[model samples]
Target: MQVEYQAPLQRLNTFGIAARARCLVRVRSEDDVRALLRQPGWDWQHTFILGGGSNIVLAGDVQRTVLKVEIPGRRLLREDERGWLVEAGAGERWHDFVVWTLQQGWPGLENLALIPGTVGAAPVQNIGAYGVELQDRFHSLDAIDLETGETFTLHHEHCAFGYRDSVFKHDRPGARGMGLRGRALITRVRFWLPRRWRPELSYQDLQRKVAETGIQQPSPWQVLEWVCAIRRAKLPDPAVLGNAGSFFKNPTVTAEQCADIIGRDPRVVHYPMPDGSVKLAAGWLIDACGWRGKTVGRAGVYEKQALVLVNRGGPQDPCSGGEVMTLARLIQTSVYERFGIRLEPEPVCVG
Candidate 1:
């Protein structure tokens, strides 16, 4: 375990906002996490877990101990006639894990290529792209209870995963559920991947790319490359420019509500949600509001993708000077004005 006080979090988070943490600890092992949790004088209310920090935004200084989970390892635990059970540490970089699986000829994660964040955070959000979700291949995960310092194994059912949500998101505290709000910290994740290839080309971009390339069935590597290309084109690279891939999740509304919104704006793009609802494209809504490439202070919507909010360099005040929150509010207000649907932010905000 590595510990530091008054740590600068600007370099830690992908958003490039410079916020100071009261204290920070990097746990490289499950034991480290257990020991840290067992320590006295650590306020449970003022503690939080962080992974790659790719899906978070720092609103101001964090008056808490930011636990950076860095435990790292990967192993093939079991294989059967159906598929292989691959286990990875929660702290492993998501893209690296996908590359490792692809290099091993494992199928299932190719569609999730180039997604930013850690493996631990994947299950929390049921991260999905190119028509594949983490829950589809998730086997189980190990997490530690913050209060008791006890470790528990959670299966798919226990996770209670939904579209961009899980037990970690909606479950009530102390309510017979794996509530994500400051209750448990994910340590390791297991994925069940198939040996045989079953390529998914349902996403419009994937379908268009395959058709344009004239490939009947592309290999997993080819699929990964194409997805990477698409993501690179659509989402701003956090390394080059500070920004989360997508600030807001696509809004899912009832069929009747969808019809009403489309009637108001015919150009609205809609996807069929799994639960008989309609998922409206947030980018389309934002672009329709003429928010693309619009700048406010140092924050602005990305030129190519309206879903992304970029922190254009300007004044140095990390908390107030940046325009991210302003732009996000603008998007939310405009979308709400144009359509009745509310846009929920995907990134966790810390202060």
Candidate 2:
């Protein structure tokens, strides 16, 4: 385990928000975590587990001790006629892992290429893109209870996965729901990639790739290239521009609510789900509210994509977490007032 006090976190988070951690501890293995637990004066309860720092907004200097997960390993755990079970340590970059799987002839994770963050953080956010979600490929995960220092494994049904949500995002009450939020540190994640893989081209962007490229039966590598191209065109690389990929979750509304919104605006972008609900395009709403490329303080909306919030000041004078949230709130209020749909942010706000 590596430890640093008063650690500068401006470069840690994707937003490039200037902040600091009271103490930052990098755990490279399960043994590191266990060793930390044995140390005197260590307060595990108030510790914050950090993975890739890709999907977070640092509001201010964090008072809690930051535990940066850096464990690393990847292998084909098992394989058969059905599929292969792959495992990756928590610290492994999510996008790189996805690409590695495809290069090895594993195809299930192709749709999720180019996403930022680490393998450990994937299950926490239930990260999804195109027409695929983490839950779709997830087999199980291993995490350690911070409070008890006990390691445990949770399978698909135990995860309670939802749209950009999972058990890891919720706080556990007294013997109630299985909420691991802030209480467990994920160490490794396993995925089930089937032998008979099928491509997911239901999303409009992927469909457009099919039409433009004239590749009806796209290989996993082709799909990965296309997804990377699409994301690069729409979302700014975090290395270049400080911003999360999508600022808001696409709001889902009931059929009646959808009709009400459709009545208000004929050109509202929406998609019907299998469960009879309608998903509205959050970027479209923000664009309709005239927020695209707009700036407030040091934060601004990406000119190319309305769904992304960016740091206008860059790294030299990067935006504060407060400025980002202020701009986000203003955008949310405008969208709500205009469309009657409350937009939810995709990134977690931390301090």
lDDT winner:
2
Residue clash pairs of candidate 2: none
Q: Candidate 1: misplaced stretches above 4 Å?
A: 314-322
**The 10-residue segment with the lowest total lDDT in model 2:** 171-180
Q: lDDT of all the models against the reference? A: 0.85, 0.93
lDDT of 2 by residue, 104-161 (tens): 8888999999899999999999999999999999999999988778999999999999
Superposition TM-score, candidate 1 onto the true structure:
0.96
Q: Model 1, poorest ten-residue lDDT window?
A: 314-323
Predicted structure with the largest TM-score when compared to the true one = 2
Clashing residue pairs in all predictions, respectively, total 1, 0
- Candidate 2 total steric clashes: 0
Model 1's alpha-carbon lDDT is 0.85
lDDT (10s digit) by residue, model 1, range 1-351: 899999988888888887888889998888897788768775656788888888788888888888888889998998888889999998999999999998886778999999999998899888999899999999999998877788999999888888788888764565565576766788999999987767888999999998899997899999999999999989888887888788899988899998998788777899987779989899899999899999887778899999988878732644232357777887899889878778999888777
